[model samples]
Target: RLLTKMFSNHLQKKLTTLSTLTDLTISLDGWTDNSGNSLYSFMALKENQEIVLDILDLLADHHTGNFLKDKLKEVLSINGIKILSIIACVTDNPSNIAKVCMGVSVYEQGFRYCLSLSETARPKYPEIENITIKNIISDRYHFANNDALTKVIKPIVDAIGRLESNDSTLADIFKELINIHQQISQLEVPINGLKAHALAIISKRAREFDSDIFFIALFLSPPHKFLAISRKMSGDKIIRASLELAKTWNFKKIDTSLLFKDLLSYKNNDPPFDTPFKSSSQSLRSYWSEFTGNAPLLHRFAMKVLVIVLHGASCERLFSSLGLIKSKIRNRLTPDNLSILGQLRNELKKTVHIKENSNKTVTEFSTYNKARPTGF
Candidate 1:
């Protein structure tokens, strides 16, 4: 118990530092453990790093949207994370989780807009698109159309897969959706029939998982700054959305007027932004880092938006470790003990090194040499 307290304190300090360093995307999902306890895991992700935030044993509490929302608030408050520091909240079950996003205060307005946008973006009966394709395949008694459909659906599936990556950002997701729309639009008539249907579904699903934050992130990303124009999304609209998001994030020190001007300069490819980058593969973080002196406020804001992780896969991934730790033989482990063990396992994976020699792997605690506390 003493060691568990020490480790818990160490992990809490690390989470506090993470909250201060960058904006986080809170990814959450629920599952049942071997002991029949209903567990919901919360993970905080930014850029390429993921921190396990908490695992709640819901016990007999109903998992309704309102109930989950209060629990989410409790977790954030305990971890010292401010509501404004969250870039997005992602989960697999959108129908229920949507309430969690929309029941909050000012942020609820953005989510409300998302729901409205999704409704307006599609026809009332969008499933007819899929039914049309199926009828064609059945009536014609041919499989060629099936192959063509695969080409269209494969890209969309791959794009969704990319979201599960730890490094995926909001801009990456936006770009993928746009690319899928374009790819579908370019297909010939019968295949193109899927265009309106595909686009409507994409817009609806995208908005369900995202909000104006996505557009702002796309505008901030260096390579994608001009891509939105191709989709008829006006620069002014994106700028206004960016400003609104900044306000919601409680960035009081930002000079909106100067930030607007800097946005124009980047959009127009003026001055510093005009100079071609030395490498086409420059990362978003590194690209934004270079502009801190020239566009301080914009740089600060961009860094926050660009670091957001787009999916709840990290939270899901943690469940595998949780399952192993709480196997049938270990079903009696308390939730506190489970959480401590899980965090220690994660931390050790980072600080320990494994070397292979003569068909044997040696485990070495590298942090011991650096005099870092390992909570032993």
Candidate 2:
């Protein structure tokens, strides 16, 4: 009981700190354990800063959307967060969670198929052409009668520039921009011809830019993160196509600066950085190794990694710990007790690792009786 109370207090403090921070991205994953525990984890990063993992919940059976929604609400309630600060949700590209229908599927299918198929059979996708009409829905981008494609592209162009930075590569920024384009393009109804114009614009920008430093810097970061984004977004298709296109364009080799010698040595020695391994499974490990074993392996490697990113693997690990902590005597655990156990497991895991320059402290100090020491 005392251990449980202490854990609850620690969790309250952690949530309070996170709530005060601005801008957070949330990622979640579901898992099943050997003991048949169905678990979910929630992870948050404040504006690309500190990481917070909340074990969120564990269940006896499989998870569902309503369960997840309630878990999210529970976190919000505990932290006293009234509104979401930022909303970047990262989930696997193959997640069936997002594809589930919330309403009557029959009605929705009938509405979209009935009239639309008749129009589409004539090769007239009202859905596709509606894009142009939607653009005219507002004359905001129009001067006189002609639509200004330049005006439509400026914001997207600027976003690409910000995303470009020294920290990202042509491959990185290009993939992101193309994803934005794909999303706009994939909208059920073409709100405007804006998407068609946007893709052309991004493609032009990618080809014309001459920035080698940015690409090199991007490659320096561990390739694992690239896999996470690509896997979650299905943005690998965009990257694969971009890299192929890049081969045809001539650009100056990115300078390696002072570490040129070291970089070259690394290139010669290490088995070139392959795509990140997604799991301990033998098939995925073999698949990644063979798929990424090549020069200019960046695009292929990223594709393999993104196919298997998981946000909540660690949290699910804690639920395993919970079973151990609860034991058979405590099998019928209360929600409050389980929550505390999860928090304690997470907090204890956060202790920093000591390395080469480990801090040294004297465990024992020499003590002297002043008069006796003087006489001696």
Candidate 3:
């Protein structure tokens, strides 16, 4: 309990330092354990920081949308985390779309159909009548159906993996989603099989990428701004929305009219910087950092909004670390101790600057010797 309190106190200090992040994107992810325990983890992402806000193991008989919404609101209401804006949400279970993604419905039908088999068609025994069914015939029929459908659905599954990959950023999702839709629409399914089912599943999700937060995040990226804006909203409307977002944050030194004019006339190929960055290897973040003085409000907005991760993989990331720590040889490690160890690991990763990590803390510190080392 003392250690948990210490971690909480440390979080408060970090929260105070990050108070300037008036705008935040919340990622709520839930996972179920083998023991039927439903656990929900909440994470908050800002311009330069990502932290696990809280973890709750709900004791409910079932998890529902109202339950999720209330728990999310409760976590953010504390922790000095106001302005609860959600840019994206991901789930192991695709039952609820609920402002999560623009077209989350596109992804739901495929999942729903997987569980729609009628009770009578499914029986514990191979046959109910006296005659036993031919096992080979039943197996082959299912295999043919699965083969046709799997070919279509595999790409969409791979696309989800890429989008949620640890290193992926918010800018990566838009193009991948568009490509998945194209692939889904072109699928040729068997006349009476799961191919059509598979197609509908992906096509539904493809068209659901309609969230305004998605467009704005993609718009902030110089490489994607033009292609990322939703056709539903005009270019002028996109500009207005971006500016309105800034005003809500009470951003400093924003000449709203000037910013609008500047964005209208801006060209990515010819950035305001004196030296054009030629190599495609140059990142958009670097470009925005250099252009801050020229377009202060615009730069700040891009820095904040574009920094969001496309998924909440960060919430589950600690599990891998925990697995390593609590291996078969060390499985007896207590939960509280494991939690502290995990926090220590993450807090270290966020260290900004380190002069000499291995330096001695006592009177004298030894540096790496330039001279030969033969082991004394």
Better of 1 and 3 by TM-score: 1
**Tens-digit lDDT track of model 1 for 117-221:** 555667642333466654543454234455555555766767767767756667787778777788777766365466677778878866663456767777777
Q: lDDT per residue, candidate 2, 1-376, as tens digits?
A: 7896776677677777776764355567665444445556665643223244555447753367786777777866666655435334444333223212222233544644644664567665434356665464334423322223333444455554454232332245544655656654554433356567656766775555334322332333344224323332333333333343333232123312212333342333455543344654433234333544444334333332222222333333555677676676766765555656666666665543222223332222222343345646
Instruction: Sort all candidates by TM-score, best to worst.
Output: 1, 3, 2
**Per-model TM-score on C-alpha atoms:** 0.69, 0.34, 0.61
Which lDDT values do the candidates have, in the order given? Answer: 0.70, 0.46, 0.60
Regions of candidate 1 where Cα sits further than 4 Å from its true position: 1-6, 12-22, 94-153, 181-210, 230-232, 328-330, 353-376
- Candidate that scores best on lDDT: 1
Worst lDDT window (10 residues) for model 1?
95-104
Q: Using lDDT as the measure, what is the rank order of every candidate, best first?
A: 1, 3, 2
